[model samples]
Target: MKKGIRRFGGYKFCFVAAVLAGIAFVIPAAWAEDGVTDSEVVIGQCAALEGPAAGLGTGMNVGMKACLDEVNAKGGVNGRKIKFIASNDGYEPDKTVDCTLNMIENEKVFALAGYVGTPTAKAALPIVQEMKVPLVGLYTGAGLLRNPVSRYIINIRASYDDETEALVERIVSDLGIKDIAVFYQDDSFGLAGLSGTEKALKKRGLKLAGMGTFARNTEAVKGGLASIMAAKPGAVVMVGPYKPIAAFVKEAKAAGFNPVLATISFVGTENLIKESGDAANGIIISQVVPSPDDTSIPVVRDFQAALKKSFPNEAPSYGRLEGYVTARVLATALEKAGAALTREGLIDAIESMSNADIGGMSVSFSKDNHQGLNKVYMTQVGGGKAKPVAKVARP
Candidate 1:
């Protein structure tokens, strides 16, 4: 009887010790090192949180925060909490590279997510490729990020080609405007958008009526606007950032060129409506995501609720949608990456996903193709709101 009691006690003690060991194994490691083990997963982002495009940075930052916070509240991903360390690059390529390198080297983040800008994000591609870190959902329209086959980067939004082509098609088919002109920034972004516009026009047996290119950070777009206006095109398409877009519109309006305006997804028509006052009326632009003003859409409603609950003081904006989608994609990849969460595992998991849908829009990815959202939405400014006219188009 004594021997049997001792045996039973020993068995119970061993079982309790094994259970404790199992709990320790399941707990993820904190963000003290590069890879997140069985406590937290650290993701890094280098966004334009300050500088000229601070509004965009703020929106995206808020979206990412809302998403990660929600995830943390819900017990995190794979029994590990997500910690995002987002830095402001001030829209400078040098600063972007520095911040990204620091995140990878010092912060020891598992992957790079929601990086902002074309020039800045492009600058860090070499290092990301060299280090083999998963560069997912870069916030840029430059085709090179997903094209010409870079192994590291994945794009969350549609390319400029998709938006530009859709706008050009509408100009030719729907609006029936023959003499079209283009005002583009004189960089990779400008060239890529112009290329798409040219291709679309060429299909309709039409050519550019006039063209003007401006350097980045130069508000002297009046000269370009004048050049485009001189052709007296029935329609004009602009490919530039918000500051330049606003400057062009204001200058063009001042010059009395009231031709129908069409632009890529980055036009920020709502913000422009507020800034330009009455001048923004009747301006049409493309959108890859749902409009904030449209509360009927389920995704927009959910997003609004998320924004309202998480960030009450701030209003939901376009860039915030970008960041929200960015977080969603990363979360999907992390969920699918399984228990052994490494950078390589994440890359493989994301690359394997095809036709991945996040609420309203759908994204596709493959081993050879990294461009996620290839669909574009065409929207027009009417009655003090951006109204989506047509369904999404994929290229």
Candidate 2:
């Protein structure tokens, strides 16, 4: 059954009906899980599809589709096709809660993947814990996500702590940069990077020369730019989406302030360049995933081929690579779960992976350690796109 869109609080949400629909069902030889019938296993996602962070959602969806298409064409994992349903949260915390509940209570998803932003994930965490739903490959490095130990969440990327630690060390050592300033989005996502940068700088017996903040979901960068430029630090670590980051860069360049600027992966790299135009030159960015253009790794080539096959017109990007990696990890776990394929079995299979190598990258997970990837890569804008520089030395 095709789902209809209904207006809610001046926003039209079209995923609600299809999320709860069960059609063309077949019975398994034995029982499995709530989402896993004989023919399909449903997965849910809550992403920012209609807001400042919309690009990230759309790009990830495309990559996920490519991976799924390949898997389903091969008869899927144990003959069960994968069904993905996504809802838009507009990058709002409150809406994240609503979408999460609808996915779990109404849609009965086996797991959730590619939930974007720290604030949105923060809002949805407690509910995930309460309901015991698996959360895989969320695109944030908030301290809360890595701390206090939630059994339901499996993190695929390096934490902001890891990224910031590596970045600060590189700036202090290789670039001989001091008097560093920080510009961040004013939310959990921003705070996570801020806290990481602070801790990393503290280890070197130094503190931030300056700090500035911008509101979530808005590209108001006048205040943040002015405050950071006032300090005149050798470099600044930006923590926000691409629009605000780009606005800050463009405005700061116009005002004749072009210091060494670096940003975390949450700041959509492609969008930043497009929005900032020529002003994006010489900017630094830390990435958790490898470049999609690097064909040396088999995974990169696979991702490029899948992207072209699934979305011939769309270009390969960091966002799509992240999504492709997440879907690949989930698919691997599902294969290990056997024909039974219970949610518990899936979790167990993932946890049991010991130093699993995925295309030149190492991933490991255990009952105690839920983090899969510990590596972070750095890139700098040389021409029109971000080019890989080197790997950040882990602290």
Candidate 3:
């Protein structure tokens, strides 16, 4: 049966008797004159809510709530209520493709939002293009999302190349470290970060001191740790998820080799801090989202308040901020796309984005550019918390 929009739930009026005379069983609600009915405006997302990258997914879910709650409180966009449908793809490429298909075909979502993982998101790219659904706020540093197939994808975070350049520049310029080593997983993600580091180093007349590879499933990373330690460099950069991060930290500390450990946003920093405790202190990582630890900021304060109200026991993390940013950017685009919120209208709205700040950072998009954020900020882990080190800037 089609649910009708009533004032409260009393069924005070008998207007339905007049409307029910028509052939169609479901009559449009009176408030839905502009096409935004009381049913729902559906949106979908797929993330690694299970498996290794689950922390990231959980965080994004929290942020998604923040956005939706805020939107619903204020009459929603175009009088349509936002209904978000999210699923877990287990951080696997093949699983992501299937999950995305289900979201599109079964759920009939208006667009894709807060999709996480580079490899996982990449698996669904062809479907996004084929179905003409807008993929918004993809949480990864992979450049493939922006290059070649930039039209359908709206990237909100800085790319791996941007983070790599900042990390390498800091290692070479500020730290005065020449012998830099890199340890990464043997996959497309690691390869992409490696390529960015190499390209950035080329501008400074230097090369990688050592390179080590580990499989994504490698829980015992002693071999990779030993390989990276053998280089005896002043700093070592890593491009892998949280499991290896903890393993490498434990093994490297045990080996009495504590080189400056830096990583792209993908090291699952929140999980590392939770597992490693004090060991996570002093470790540096790049971030594309605002620091949740810094609660003094107004945006962070409001986010915390909303999060506490909705999910009091749940802890805020990197993925939460990422998810919030994704929704904020998409809603901003939709607002600019006008009352007719179609996929093409969204693309055009995003393409015309300019100087719009979300909380702390300014996000912009252009006709030929879809990279929403170009600056990357450095963060240091200390006292079991991730703190922003320097202001975001062009790398």
Top model by TM-score, which number?
A: 2
**Candidate 1 lDDT over residue span 97-203, tens digit each:** 78877887689889888876677777788778766788887766788786786878888788887887888887777766888888998877678778878878888
**Residue 52 error, candidate 3, Å:** 1.6
lDDT, each prediction: 0.76, 0.84, 0.76
Which is superior by TM-score, 2 or 3?
A: 2
- Give me candidate 2's TM-score against the actual structure: 0.90
C-alpha positional error of residue 206 in candidate 2 after TM-score superposition, expressed in Å: 1.0
Instruction: Give a tens-digit lDDT track for model 2, residues 226-296.
Output: 99988989889999999889989988888999778889998888988898888888888888999989989
User: Among all windows of ten consecutive residues in candidate 2, which has the lowest summed lDDT?
Assistant: 1-10
How do the candidates rank by lDDT, highest first?
2, 3, 1
Taking all chains together, each candidate's TM-score versus the true structure is 0.87, 0.90, 0.86
lDDT of 2: 0.84
RMSD of each: 12.2, 6.3, 9.1
Off by over 4 Å in 1: 1-35, 293-297, 391-395
* Pairs that collide, model 1: 27-38, 28-37, 28-38, 28-39, 29-39
- Angstrom error of the Cα, residue 65, model 2: value is 1.3
